[model samples]
Target: MAERTRQNNGNGKHVWRGIVIAILAVIVLAAFISSRKGEVPVRVDHVTKQDLITTISTNGKVEPMENFEAHAPAPTTVRKIYVREGQRVRQGELLMQLDDADARAQAARALAQTKAAEADQHAIQSGGTQEEVLNTRSELVKAQAERDSAQKNYDAVQKLAQTGAAAPAEVREAASRLTAAQAQLKVLQDKQQDRYSRPEVNRVEAQVEQARASYTAAQDLLKHSEIRAPFEGTVYSIPIKQGEYVQQGELLIQLANLRRVQVRAFVDEPELGKLAVNQPVTVSWDALPGKIWRGEISQMPYTITTYGTRNVGQVLCAVDNEDSRLLPNINVTVNVSIANKKDVVTIAREALHEDENGRYVYVIRNGHLERQTVEAGIANNTRIEIMNGVQPGEVIALNSMNAGTPLRPGLEVRAR
Candidate 1:
């Protein structure tokens, strides 16, 4: 009986072991089948030909194309202001005036002095005044009379001597008297000549010139007391009131030509490399609501700088402001179209990936994932331009949620 029991136990053990091995074989086979049969659920997209416009957005500042700032010319009181803020004015229009009583008085004094100096110069250049000329003429007449009388006496004495009526010694004395009278007449005429030395005239003329220069300077200072518009524009600021005392170089007024405006864009340093000259730009301001301003990049910064809390590079653009709606120093949104493409194959940026071989994407076809290497061009925040390696209308796998978990070659996928 013991031998029979032992044989039965061995049989039972072999039977149980065989059953367990068979069950384990079945489990392994089921696991393999499930692994091969399962599909990865993924987000997918169809590559399409579309226009892609790549842009970089940033904040910008609005400024006038031409700005003018006026300052006080002297430490004086403001007498009058002709134009108010927001008033349009023509070039050279009188804008304001300071108390010019002192300047005007100084100008009058300078004018009087200039005239006096000019008169003195003229008298010296002309040798003498009218009265002195008349006196010289009288002296010339008297000397001429004396010379004529003495000559007549000498002639008469010579005639008498020839006729034997006057002694020879008396004739000689008469001739000597005539000679002395002629010499005296010549000396008187020389003293009374109209010509004066050049040095004396030039000295007086220098005084006249100095006085004239002073008069000109005084006139200029008086004119400067009244401010004038430097160009045709609108006055936007006035810091001084009438009858207010102001110092020299104080702020007086601010003006600008609002026909056109400029925008200064502060771009992040990372995006600065994408900026270029003449790129199309769009600007909008919160204050103006629905209005859009159009422009193009006119200037770009050569180096990076700091703006507020960010390191940025500056870019300048010009906007048309014919209606003068956009004001100076206003904040606005700036969009720069850095790159663009016409009709081209594109995919969402999320569908693209990069590896050592460069950029790539997974194409889903026939329930399998196909790895594709591609050349990419311009890309914006949401879309990427596929330059090559992927055809239009190909399905691209974006995401997967399964055991395999990611896009892989020959992996089974089902797009949702």
Candidate 2:
């Protein structure tokens, strides 16, 4: 009875092991069949002939084509503000006014100084002042009269001496008086003739010029204290309150014509070569969504400069803002259209692949994916121009439906 029981247990162990092995073999075969027969659903596109435009995008700023800025001409207080921010003003309209009392006082003082300097210059040129000239004339007349009197007395003394009525010593004293009077008269005449030297005249003239220049500058400051619009524009900025004190050269107001504007685009140095004058450009501001402003390149950069972390060139684009929506100094995005090709064979950019052998695309022909080497031309953000190897109406794989599934030639695929 014990031997029979042992024999039965051994048979049962063998049977159970065989059954487990059979079940595992069936699962492995089923997995292999499923993988082999699975079809990779992919996104596909049809190659077609259409217009394609190539563009490059970069950051920019909106600025007025005609702009004006005013600063404090002298240290003063803001007297009044005629226009508020965002006010539309005509040319020559008053915008703001500074406390011009000090400027006027300075101008008046300068004018007085100029007048005084001019009087001094005139006096120097004319040899002497009116009073001094009159005094000298009076002295000349007195000296002449004394000389004549002394001469007459000397003549009388000579006659008396000849007539033996006067002594020789008296006649000699009369001659000495005449000589002294004549010397005094000669000194007065010389003094009138050369009252000032050449250097003295030059010095006075220079002072007159300096005073005149100072007066002119003072007048200019006074005029600038009353700010006026240089052209028809919109006032965009006023940095001070009506009663605020400001220093010379401090920013006061800013204005610009909102009818026309320019966008200054900062393009990276590598993309500078693709830029040219008259190229179409589009600008969009983040502050105003869904609004686009169109323009053209007005000026090209002559030199490259560092902008943030990029070496960039500044390109100017002229835009029309007739509605006056775009404001100055606003940040915006710019797209420059470099090239436009019409009616050309094109494909989605994702369908074009590049490798060591150059550019290629997988085309769907007769219900199977076929890899074809391609020659490409210009490309834009979403599409690429295929010069050859890919024809119109051919379907190409954009991407695999299952992520990470490799796109291979001869793989069976169906559009998702």
For each candidate in the order shown, give its overall lDDT on alpha carbons: 0.87, 0.92
User: Candidate 2 at 397: error in angstroms?
Assistant: 0.9
Model 1: residues >4 Å from true position, as ranges?
1-49, 55-61, 89-94, 143-199, 228-231, 264-279, 285-291, 297-316, 330-334, 364-369, 391-416
**For candidate 2, lDDT tens digit of each residue in 4-85?**
9999999999999999999999999999878656778889999999999999999999988899999999899999999999
**Which pairs of residues collide in model 2?**
none
Candidate 1 per-residue lDDT, tens place, 1-416, comes to 99999999999999999999999999999998798667778899899999999999999998878888877766789989998988889999999988888789889999999999988877775557878778777887988998899999999998999999999999999989889889978976776663567687778888899999989988987988988888998888898798899998999888899887899999999888777899999898888788888889999998888888999988999988777777788889998998888998899999999988788999987999999999999988888999998999899998886645767889888788
Q: List the residue pairs that clash in candidate 1.
A: none
Quote model 1's TM-score: 0.68
Off by over 4 Å in 2: 1-36, 144-179, 197-203, 403-405
